[model samples]
Target: MAKAIQKITLDRSEDIPFDKLELSQKNVRNIKAGVSIEDLANDIALRGLLMSLNVRPVLGDNDEETGRYEVPAGGRRYRALELLIKQKRMAKTEPIPCIVKRGASTSVEDDSLAENVHRLQLHPLDQFRAFQTLHLQGLGEEEMAARYFVSVSTVRQRLRLASVSPRLLDLYANDEMKLEQVMAFSITNDHVRQEQVWDTVSRSHVREPYYIRRLLTEAAVRAADRRAVYVGVEAYEAAGGVVMRDLFEQDQGGWLQDPALLEQLVFEKLKTDAEALKAEEGWKWVDAAIDFPYGHASGLRRFYGERTELSADELARYDEVKAQYDKLDADYAKAEDYSEETETRLEELGNELDRLNDRPHVFDLEEVARGGVFVSLDASGELKIERGFVRPEDEPAGEVDDADDGDNDGNVGVATSVTGGISVNGKPVAVETQEEEDDKIRPLSDRVIEDLTAARTIALRNALASDPIMAFVAALHAFVLKTFFLYGSDSCLEVTMQSAKFGQTQGLGDTVGAKEIEQRHEAWGHDLPKTPAELWDYLVALDEASRQALFAHCVSLSLNAVVQPWNRRPAAIAHAEQLARSIGFDMVDAGWTPTVDNYLGRVTKAHILQAVREAKGEQSAQLIDHLKKPDMAREAARLLEGSGWLPEPLRLAVDETPAVQSNDDAAELVGDNVVEGADADLPAFLAEDADSEDAASEGAEVEEHRHLDPAE
Candidate 1:
């Protein structure tokens, strides 16, 4: 009882002449899509016909073959062949490969729809690997680009993606990572590091491409950094240095792998340039550095020279250019829109005017011989040469004062050193006598004023710090003055805080806090208006929340908790303490604790013991008192790990408005946690005193006491 299966006949295929093949009207493709007909023709010309056309025989009314074929599925290929024939690349009489379908059950429309819908495109990863293979097969990037009709940059990107770590490629192939994330990994070739970064970012909430790049380039120097810019990438590469580039995104200038080498090149070039400048300018000295601090020239006396006189021809040219510039500017300002030609001409005229005005200064030969230039890089990475600076040590001594010579008539003779300024009416004013000048107080020197003001500012800061309400009000006052007042006030204590510069510290720029601050500053600066006149309105238009946040950031920048050996600033230190107390600010919360590297190793044994005694009790302090300084410090650090202890300078004074506590809570928050019980097993160091009555009583009370640890 088995059912019989019916057999089906297949359609026949045959070759037909190119001239005999006609386009099918039943084809479903009406509009143009992927791969233009022109491109298809070129492809067919390069690598003959890869696909045979699906054709059905056209029959006459007699039901016989018409010796002609009609293409349905391969319409594009037919058109390409026809195009090639028209271009004389192929003959109309040439035989064309065709699959002839002589059945009526399956329509040409069905065949055409199936052919277009059933085809699959290659995966991106596969395409990347294919490009890599082609590159390995001796096909140049430009050639591949030409063959595929893609840009050279696109080809490069695919190659870069293919060059990523094998693990990353596997991840991409397995659909474990996104294509953009994989592109980020292509920035570096180190498989281990790539895997490490991937593992890290895979768990982070933000797995953006930029964050990945940031993490990878954390230790690397930016190509736009002053050192890297000074030493061109070409030179760095020529000297065997490597650079990590991002092909998918704009990386500005990419990342330099070898910062040390770049720095070395920068210094060497700077030194050579400095020497050249010194020799050419006949300077006393040429101090060269990659950068000079904010106040590098604070103590130096600067003298500017007169600009050299211009020749008659130069003067005429300058006047002509200035006139042209003024006319063009006025015209442009009056117009609703600027004309390209006028703008270009204005720029040219401006440049010419600058060229005529930017004449070299003519310094006195004697002053030039005594002064020197400070050569460094500016913020924009350009050579900044500050000339005509005379150090105090290099200044010529003043003439010694002598007793005023008197004539026999008993009248005092004026010294030649006497000098006076001319009156507004042109007559020389009488010089004041020494006695009269002594009676009238003279203005203090700049250095002295700075020192004294620095002291007063510190005292005021201390007073402000002790009162948080006052600090807040002062910040608001400062903001209001800056926003509403057009001119500066007479008050000497204006809280104009700027970022602190670590003049002596090396690698200060590499610190985490410094980088964060710089990035935030740049972000804010980019959003701010360029014109100072527009700034007040812009700030006023901002929301209240944004204004407060900006105010807080600006105020926080003014907080000076720094301690230096040479620059004591005792009042500032005191202010820092008061501020800490006012805000309940704990250094431990700010990622600092007693450690051998930062604190313990640097302090004495006695100091360590005292700290332990204050943190832990007397018994705990005695336990490590006998050890050497190093051992004591290490032991003290372990015992005081979470004890909320601070050094003297960092300690806050007692808060006047201290939190009120209950009797039980006061006892609990007094010191180290102490249990109300007899002494448990004591350490060997304290065993000798374990039998003492005082120790027993103290142990019972110490056991019940507890205090909050800032480290917690």
Candidate 2:
């Protein structure tokens, strides 16, 4: 070895004329990847030739020098240079730096393959740091992106990564942490906090990126939150509120740093809006808040207003739409299956008619004089105004008299509205009551009355169960009590309806299902009697159709089709199916589309692909199958939208939820369903989609919902 290594002759490098170099077919990279030709050209123009091209002399038919060189590697650079010359940006005879291979034993193809195969891609951290270093050298993100042949957002993301705590960056570089974890940490710039989260996650087994982000931003409020949406990001920023963003992932509009500031902004804006609305709408007073308890107007007497009649033009539009709808329905009446075009036109016509008929209610000036409005933000961040609620003091003395109403039930807490006597054997049987003989009348003791009413209650229950109509009314009375008067109670029917809250689910309150349910609940709540004592008389006055409609609405609230693992209710699941089947309930029609946050994002990679494949096609799924889980999920959501594709939990099975063949299971199912309430259960968002659709349908966390009904 001391004799020295054998001397070797290196390939000679020289500046070859641009016209003298041509690309060789031996280049291994045929398909385009990474940076594009145009981007590469632009990068090359900005930073001259950073790497020299490899070339071999072209031999003519005579086996002599043809004065041209064939480029085995760096063909892209050759094309880029050739392009610049054609654009007159460079001379045709411009010298291109290249290594000229002569007398080399290696073939040109071998050289090209070796060059590509042996090249190691720059580490992601290195690239991120390089971008950061350029920014430190006085280059803005935009300018650096232009020079690097990447997007400005990409540059910012890389810089964000570099801005992460150096210690975490080292851990990432050493492969102790993942790219996603680093991306999550980059959501904020606080190194101390970043290191602290890292330390917390590093010691725990739950180091998922989602968990990491949660730990970091646990205290921050989401910008998509109702308050933030009401105030708006720009307004918040204008008020000096900071929003933390994750450029690498969907952050649901990022997280707002200042909850107090957001609340202040929301209140101020709401106050302004309420004052304006009160002045314009001519209400006695307007109360503004971000939210109110479900039945904030429980004790207040609400008045219903007649809708303003449609004008000639509006009437004509409604007639036209109605005619079209009728014609379409007639045309499709006999068809076994409706064509898509027909279905679409029918939907459009129906929507048009609904819009035309949805005339705004015009309250009487007298009613408006005494009634106040409750103005608050709805699930969708829009202002919801509840009008025509009158306080008890505001009502004229004796305007609403107890005796004027037809019911003669002595006790205000009576559950039945049987007029005078209890129904016995399809006949009214009056019960003698002891009345005061003196001018100062005395009443029966609580124990005596309770005993008498208990027997009366038993008779009423038996009779009402036989009479479907009254059974329906009885349920509605219980629902009204629970819905409107939470603090007090008078109804004998012990029914409860609690609307399961989605305080923890992101953007759930803003869902279409949520908004529709809340609006429906509020409408019924406002229309109901103020106190349970008046409920029996008030419900008895409604027409048959109106009462049935009210009963249906009340019964709909206690629907809990959610499948939870801890509380397995196979019979209930099947019952929900039977219910869905009865109503032609389609989750797709309910406006629940597959979304990354709601569905695809929660599932495994294979499920995402399967969903895409089913909704779109194999080719479509294949295109995104190679992407990472997040990207694949996002792509699948887009592809599934408007396709009417439903996940297993949402899809109504063709047969049923399976065996309800057991009689005990059947009786149990009926008993469970009989307890329906006045608050809507969280619909299958495919909620949590936590369980397998094949294993169980619409698996949701176990939450209780209650309801009541009436008799003939």
Candidate 3:
């Protein structure tokens, strides 16, 4: 039959008539508008229409109320055109090309159903969307399936896919997963399982459709199981599937999932089965020889008579097969040529051999029984035979006559014996005896004692040395005790005299009084005795005593130095005098000359003198003369400059002294020999030197220059 062709001119909206359209309402399914009308309009503007619209002729006469006809399948296209027309991009009168079917013989529903069932093949997702649209429109699954020429199960599966969580549907729509993957994931009807499938599929880089489906399937199953999901090649074997040796050897996911556990379980089962097999069969040897002409039939055999009943032809055939296997086994046994394939084949052959050898063979009891085999008659009078070169039944059994005679020596007997000495009724009896030998004893040597004593000495020294105050007190006690023992009641005076001498030597003088010295001596010496042995004990204590005294004296000196004002130099001198008096010594005898005291006094006086001289703008000749000495000039210059005595010019001159020397011999002579001249010119030079020196000294002052007295 020639196909009917028709040309159609229809209103843009009415051109694709719903009545003549072949796509069923069920087939029209859900007209899911994924994109907005704006997007469709844009797509139409750029690409025009890629698909032809389905339409049907208007029934009876055209509508009189409206000038346009209704659309069928091209609703989206019609809307797009309407947008373009409103935007003035397309003419309102423009005619859209479409195919039309006559409505006289076909109902709108029948045409729609035929178009969806026979003409169009929709994508799984699109089909799902279509089913949803029909379902929402109140069409049943069976009716939709019948109308669309699809199975009810197919329609239901599609509907289920559509009903899947939106999160999972998005994965399908975005091409993150395939419809089949989504379909497999939909099996569980669990959102968590679907999500897991989506997650597994999306994260994987599997571009192949098969792998994506497989991964999704496995992930869904695992999500359902809620256990550690093993996938890939390892899963096959772990699930008890038989795998080829080569396949097993490969690093497939099946074995890789948990190799240790799988291998252990497999080998343990194999071992258990092998042990059980071994126990069921008594030990027996089968001829392993391979015949040359008859292949494996060349070796000796010791089987029972009944096994020998097989024809020679049957044996020869067996030998031929066995020989071929032997050759293969020999080739495999070569180390360089050995491989998993060969090993697997060898294992199979060995297993077969084991099975064959396990078969039972009949034997004559009378002939075997005379050759060390045992024959027994049971209560039922049935004869039983055991065959072997060595019969266990013929071996002699051991006997024990008495439990006490463990060795079973017929003639030997045991007798009781006593230790130390044997006695009967208090009378000594003859007994075996051994002699005792003497061993020499030695005493500890002097060297060992010396080492121990040295260790003790070091411990004591460390304890005494820990604190200087303790050492000082120990020294005082020792001195007092030694004096007391040597001179009796005169020790107090003697100790006072020594303290005085010590104070004077340190220049502390009379600040430390005799009463304080006596009190300190008594406090430290009270624990000591007046005997020679006590003197030794006092000496031991002296180290700490002396340390205490020295520390005390140093503290007193520091206090005096800090407390005395800059103008009170004689205060320290007087304080030293007091210390000397307390220790029962004259300050002068302890190296405190009047000059030394005066020098210290001058240190305080000089600071004031320096400031006064600086304020007057006139240097003191006495001070300047004292500072001019080689050792004192640098220090004096520092103090003078620090005090603002010299003006900017002299200060600059002093600073430029090095450069002046570098200029020439005369310049050198001027800087080196001009001090006296500089001093002489002080009235004019001091002003300039002071200003320049002040600017030069702006940042950090030299610490050495801040103090006027060098002793300070």
What's the TM-score of each model vs. the native? 0.58, 0.58, 0.20
* RMSD values, in order shown: 19.6, 16.7, 42.0
Tell me which residue pairs clash in candidate 1. Answer: 673-705, 674-702, 674-703, 674-704, 674-705, 675-703, 675-704
**Candidate 3 per-residue lDDT over residues 1-712, each given as its tens digit:** 9988888654343343322233323235356645667777777787777666656544445533232344466566667777888998877766666765443375655655565567555567787888999999999989887666567977887787787778878877888666656655554445765576566545544334444334433322221121122122344355663321111112222212233444344334333433343234332211110000100111111223333444576556557657767988877667675488877877776666555444455544433332222222222222223233222222224421333233212111111111221111111222322112112212222222222222222222223333445445534643654554332211111233221111111112122232243334334443344344666656566676564654554332122211111222222222222232333332222222222121212223343344335544445534343321222333343344434342211121212223444446666543234322223322122112222135445333233224422321
**Between 1 and 2, whose lDDT is larger?**
2
For 81-192, candidate 2 gives per-residue lDDT tens digits of 8888877888999898899998789898899999999999999999998888889999998888778777899988999989999999898889998998999998988899
Q: Which residue segments of model 2 deviate by more than 4 Å?
A: 1-12, 18-33, 56-70, 85-89, 101-110, 136-142, 311-356, 398-712
Model 1 spans with C-alpha error above 4 angstroms? 1-12, 316-347, 398-712
Q: Which of the two, 1 or 3, has more lDDT?
A: 1
Q: Write the per-residue lDDT of candidate 1 for residues 1-712, one digit (tens) a residue.
A: 9999999876666668899989999999999988889988998998899988888888999989998878898999999999999999999999988878885687789999999899898999999999999999999999998788789999999999998888888988998889989988889877788889888777655477876786788779988887787778899999988899998888887999888888888877877787788778877766676755323443455666667889998888788878878887987899997599987888888888888877887667787787777677755578878787665556687521222112112111111011121001111223322211121222222222232223222333333434445457546645664565433221212366643333333333333344444455444654566457988999999997666656555565465544443333333344444455555554444433566644566545655777898889999988776665655676688788888886644444444434787888667733333212111222121112223236666585344222211111
lDDT of 3: 0.39
